[model samples]
Target: MKSFAPKFVWFDGRYVRDSEANVSVMTHAIHYGTSVFEGLRGYWNSKNLNIFRLEDHVKRFRNSGKVYSITLRFTDRQISDAITALCRKNNARQSCYIRPFYFVGRYGINLHVTEKSPTHAAIVMFPFGDLFNRNGISAGISSWRRINDSSTPPLAKMGGNYLNSILATQEGKRNGYDEAILLDHLGNISEAPGENIFLVRDGKMITPPSSSSALEGITRSSVIEIARDLGYDTVEREIPRTEIYFSDEVFLTGTAAEITPITSVDGKPVGNGKAGRITQKIRNVYSDIAMGRNKKYSRWITPVY
Candidate 1:
């Protein structure tokens, strides 16, 4: 989905007009990708917008910075407040995506970054919608292997690490696919370019473990919890590539992708080549939970009026 042009953004410590929220070309993050970021979604109900899983996203945002020694200038609570305030400042009345990030700034040509290094933080929000076909989409098994913990920690949502995702996505699009499914170094199912993968067989949900190079996705965890709450079993293990072709259902989960089913993988139709029953059920319930329609999951949402 296209992001709406925002009117204002939270830059450093205060809100600024979008045009004024600027970064230098020589910034450390631009040159060396020395930045950490997080993306969370806000859903608009009839009354107000709800920022889904704000606290969890903020905690992960902080952890991502810690992995790279990029300490944010703001505390977790301050960051969360900034995200909510940015939404209000932007007059976000529709569903939107929120990005809270910190980057190494003005440390010219420095390979070794320390906590004392200059840094900048900002929060931006814009109108967003479904990233992919929520009904179902085709996927290609990308030749690009996922970046592993040995080279870079997959758990950390660092900007440089996404080069791997970029390559996989490029290859997938070139090969006539809606998204890319990358395999781990060992040729096991890892995840989509920007989302986590789940396989259903024998009425159970299966996904690759974080050890297999999959990010510990917040949406993936939420899907597991929702599935288990619905009485479906969930498992985390290394999945062979061939198993996906045989699974009863396959879907991807992320803050952006949400819960999108895979109707076909590499031209082979999955199950009946349509969104599966369980996937539809989970997606429906997830939409409700995120949109403030499900009071039982009210704790997962923070309303921004």
Candidate 2:
């Protein structure tokens, strides 16, 4: 784990030094986790810097804010521009991760915030590399189950919801596993700590549907599209835990995780126990797209510079 300190961060209304961008201790988001955020990646391709699915990320950010009753002071285009400006100001000429967050800034203990309660938005960019082992990762079925929509909406990228993920991930790490795959309340496969899970069987790609309490990930959607373009059939349905152990291949997808192959689940080898042919093909094509080498999916990348 290397430290990454960016030169500038897009604060409430302007760029500020990384150290100057501070939040109050009594902030509502810190107390009750009432915040919405988005995670995206920007790739430096020679002289051209590109951000993947920038608009889609912004849209999700706005939607999450709306769901959580956190009003964003800026529009989608404004936020997008601010992120790009922040990256350029930091002189980030390499692959970096972008985080845009909206939170309740005012101090109060009450769950209901008044109009006087301030809302703040910030964008930060920093150098980020692989989030998981690229070779292959081992995962365990977590003891902690996935939270259902009735409690807190899992679809929104809310900060509070990640506490569940944190618990599950910590449990996996303690058990000598690379990651954790959480099952929904009904015992059906949901997703990993921070990524969507997919299993290949008989050459068809299968993943848990949104109804199964899985986050609607942008990268997951991209994988489905890419797989279809590669002449593979994709299905969205409830997955059983045992199915993963018996599947021909397994993988996870997300903004941070990207496309990570799951070699084993709960100590059981997935098929041959190595990255399968389908997973490798998808990973290679995804890498090409991220590096601006795939013109077929050029629209997915937004030029920042």
Question: CA lDDT of each candidate?
Answer: 0.93, 0.90
Candidate 2 residue pairs in backbone clash: none
Could you tell me how far off, in angstroms, the CA of residue 99 lies in candidate 2 after the best superposition? 0.7
lDDT of 1 by residue, 43-102 (tens): 988689999999999999999888889889899999999999888888788898888889
Candidate 2 Cα deviation (angstroms), residue 300: 0.7
Candidate 1: count the clashes.
0
Candidate 1 structure lDDT = 0.93
Q: In candidate 1, which residue ranges exceed 4 Å CA deviation?
A: 1-5
lDDT of 2 by residue, 121-170 (tens): 99888898899989899999999999988888899999999999999999
RMSD of each: 1.5, 1.8
Candidate 1 TM-score to native: 0.98
TM-score per prediction, in order, is: 0.98, 0.96
Residue-level lDDT for 167 in candidate 2: 99
